[model samples]
Structure formats: structure tokens, C-alpha cells
Target: MFKKFVLATSLAAMALSGAHAAEITFDEAIAGATVFEFDGDGDMVVDVRFGTDDPEGFNTVGPGANQTYISEPGLEGTTLLDTDLFVEFLGGAVGTLSFGFATIDPDTSVNFTVYDDNDNVLGSTTALATFDTGGDFPEALASVSFAGLASYATFDFFGVGSRYIIDNFNGTFGSTEDRTPDAVPVPGALALFAPVAAGLFARRRKAKK
Candidate 1:
């Protein structure tokens, strides 16, 4: 199961505003798998938590000339099935992201998915990408966007030996999407179902006994 533990304040934070938008270029790409936190335009909360399935998959390359970044995944004849790239865009902004890709094998594909605070999937896309050693993409368009205001999103890679590199991650965030109600306390939730649960527990114990 996809599981994540979050704080009540973080959930509450999303209710604030969605007018702000922002993006990261990793122009100052860190050398390893680490979390970088920054505030978006007008103070929206944003974070990029870079990670890898194979320790080698987490790669951060040049904050190249003209403020560019190369987010390269390490895999030669291997596969990565899920979000090796995770982002948390709080403060309710609807946003889009673009990247510069260097290389990907012909048979390899990558998937991107965005999620709301309640873990509802907001958007998804799969692509069969290609690139040569010389590198590709002078394309300057927002290729990915959220369905609504999202609290977090993920970029995953898949396919055998799908080693690819991407850079120049530019994102734009605007108004927020329709959001779900925040989670209620367990005690309050239990108030409605407590009696039913007790009955079931007792019946199960009785049967076992």
C-alpha cells in the first residue's frame, strides 16, 4: 500500500491560499539524495525530496550554464517503477513542471503521477521517451500539470536498463484545485463506529474461545 505519515499542521496548511506558484531548476543541484525546501512565489511551501530505488539511481548533475539542472537517473539496462522524484507543493497552487532529458533507451518508459492531501490521485501520464548521448530538448513548454491543487506529486521511471537524465526543471503554479476536507481526529471518527467495532471484536473473541 502507498503510505505516508503527515502532520496535522501540514494538512491544515493547504487550506490557506492557492494564488501563488513556483518551480525549481536545481540550478544549485545538490550532490546526493537530500531534501531541499523553499518557499514559492508569495510564500507557498515547496520541497523536493530526491531519492533512488537503487542507491545509484539518485543523481544530481550540473547547475549548468544559464541556471540549468540535470536530474539524471542511474540505470543501465535496469528498471525503476515508481516516483524516484517526489515533490510537495503546499499552499494550494495548481502547477506544471518541465524538464530537459538527456538519454533513455528505446524500450523504456517513465510515469508521472500527482496526488492530493487525502492520497487521491489527481493526474497521471506515461511516456515512451528517447534520447541520444548528445542529449535532447531545447523544448520550453510545461509538459506536466496537476488536476487541482496538490500537496505532493511523483515522477517515476520504468523499463529495463532505462537510464535517463533530465534537467532544467521549471514549474509554474497558479490557483489551487478543489481540495478534499482534512482528516478528522481518530477519537471523533471512532465515536460513530465504536459500538460496531466492539461488537465485532467480541464476536470474534467468542468464536475463538
Candidate 2:
């Protein structure tokens, strides 16, 4: 009985190990998606909130040198002025974050604000992401690292009348997958195995009596 319990627990641990810091390259078929969620650990979750500034929201834009990337098309009849993305980490925090971004105009800039778990501002930065003649809009990368763990972050396009796109999200948290439209939550495998292990323990105790 003990051996069976140990085996079940080990299998569940392996499943949980699958959750790790993930980098999103925007290579998947996420043409018309909005919210991207990543299961970092069994207890926490990470969400890259996007698609709030334009009519097209978050969609694949081009097949440039870097292939397809995510962007918000500020089409007509839209009040959207600037492109923005919010990365929120729930139940946990990270110390490092990086991603690639680009703008419609050359020599555009982007602004970032990072916060801690208590909603306190940790640091802010402005990165200049230029348009490459050969690569796509996401040709330049923006990276940030702080001494304290970060709970959330905000990125905004600072160029006047210009929009931006992002791709290749690298972080120090868990990994993620292409979640088009909606993403279903997946906790650690231990949640599933816990019940089985408990049942087995109960049976073993009864037999011992």
C-alpha cells in the first residue's frame, strides 16, 4: 500500500513539474485571441492581458522577417489611441521579464511600469525599439530586471499616432501556451492525485485495524 501511494505521488509531482517559465513567440495560430494565460505553478497563474486599445484587438499582423507577431490594429471608428499590454502574475512574483516589440513608425519608443505583489511600484523604464529594415515589427527586445519580485507589469506605446506589436515573451515565471479566445485553468497534477492517495490511505488504515 505504501509503495502504491509513493508511485502515485511521484507521478503527480512529475505533472506539476511541467509548469515552468514559458516564452511566447507568437508562432501559434493565435490570430484573433485576447487574453493569454499561463499556469506558472500549482498555486499561481500568469496572464498577459492584451487587446484593449484597438478594433482588431490582439491579432497576427504580418509575415515579416520574424514571421507572424501579435499587434492591435488601430483601425478607423476606434477610440483606441495607444497600444498597451498588461502582464499580471497572481499568487506569485518574478524578478526578470523580457519581450520583443516594434512600432509602425521608425524609432518608436515604449514605456513600462512594474509593480510588486503589494501593488507598490518597483521600477519603470523606457526602451527605444526601432523598426528594422529586414525584420518584423517585433525586431527589438525590451528587458527588465529588479531586485524585488514583480507581480505585474504594463507596457504602453509612447510614439504619437503610432502603434506597436509584441512577441517572444521571456520571463522568470512559468511557461504558457497559445490560448485563443479563452484559456482553461489547469492546476497542478497533485490536485488530481491527492484524492486517490487519500482513498488509498483510508483503505490501508482500515485493513490494519
Candidate 3:
């Protein structure tokens, strides 16, 4: 009897733990997405060179030759503005996407867009704040609620690129409800276990007698 009680209690505890184990976070949700860092190196040139100087006007020499600056069209000899970094999430479900970025100037406007596998726009939003002249990296967050999106991709700082740093992109799909395996049990499960254990103990006692 005691053993049966202990076993039942253990199973219950395990079930509870398993059911609540899965959690969604900003990073885990969008792991499938790709990340592109512009001027990630200390170079004064942009990754997607357009043949001209950086429009953001950042000229500091850093660890790598890549300089962190915004890209804009009409910059002579510059492909930076035209270059669009993309990421695809193979999972064909709707989820949340998020990332952090700081604009080069306080007054500069920033835009973000999400696209599906077929290159269709899912949703988009613009940052209310203008990133114009301060060096401070202000973090911006954007999200879209979509369903049945074939692929997940994003375009950041669209139109008039700004010196920006982006990271921590994530997407989450799946029920928010707790449905871990251990939490599920057979009907009359606990009651059945108790009786079966008791019957075995009784049979052993009778045999000894």
C-alpha cells in the first residue's frame, strides 16, 4: 500500500513538471530566422558596397574594417542602400518576430517589414521615434500577428538606411497552453494502480499463509 502511494505521488509530480516545462521566449521563438550584420567589421565600407561613402557618416576605425552606417539611395558608388538582408523560417505557422535596433541619428525614421515564403508581405510597422544625431543606441521593438505564413522574413531600417545595430530576433508558434506528455493520464489511472498493487500484496500474503 505504501509503495503504491509513493509511486502514484511520484508519477503525479513528474506529470506536473513535464506539462509546464516548455516556455516561449524572444530568442527561442525566432531561431530559424537569419541575421545579417552591416559593416559588422571595422572597415569604413559597407558590406553591400554601393560605390560611395557611407551615408550615416560614421568614420571610426573599429575591430573590423566594416563601418556601422545607414544606407540611402543615390549615394554614389554605394550598394549598401540597395542591399536587403533576409531570413526565412521554414516552420509554416504564424508566430511573433522581434529584434532590437538603434538608429544613427535621433531624427532618422526606421521601418520594418515581415514577408512570407512567396515574398508576400505579412505585416509591417514603423518606429515612432526618429533616430537622428545622438550616438546613443535606442532599442526598438516590432511585432506582427499572422497565421499560416509559409515563411518568415524581415527587412529592417528600410528606406534611408540609418546606422543601426540589430539582434535577438525570435518567433514563437504553438499553443500557449501547457500540454506536456507526462501531464496526460489514462482514465481511472490512479485508482487502477492502487487496486492492482493492493491485490498483488494480498496474493503474496496468502501464499505465505
Per-model TM values vs. the true structure: 0.51, 0.55, 0.40
> Predictions ranked by TM-score, top down?
2, 1, 3
lDDT of 1 by residue, 75-187 (tens): 12124545566666544434455555433345555566777779898777665554332234221122565655566666665665355555544444422333333322357
TM-score of 1: 0.51
Would you give me the overall lDDT of model 1? 0.49
Candidate 3 deviant stretches above 4 angstroms: 1-83, 129-135, 158-161, 173-209
TM-score of 2: 0.55
The sequence of per-residue lDDT tens digits that candidate 3 reaches over residues 1-209 is 99999989986984564322211212212222233223312243222111112333322111121222321110111114533334444333344455444443344334556666677877766663343323233335555555445254544354343544444343432233232222345568988898999999999999999
**Top model number, TM-score:** 2
Q: List candidate 2 segments past 4 Å from native.
A: 1-21, 39-55, 66-83, 131-138, 175-209
> Model 1: which ten-residue window has the lowest total lDDT?
133-142
Q: Backbone clash tally for model 2?
A: 6
Candidate 1's clash total is: 4
Candidate 3 has what TM-score?
0.40
- lDDT by candidate, in order shown: 0.49, 0.55, 0.40
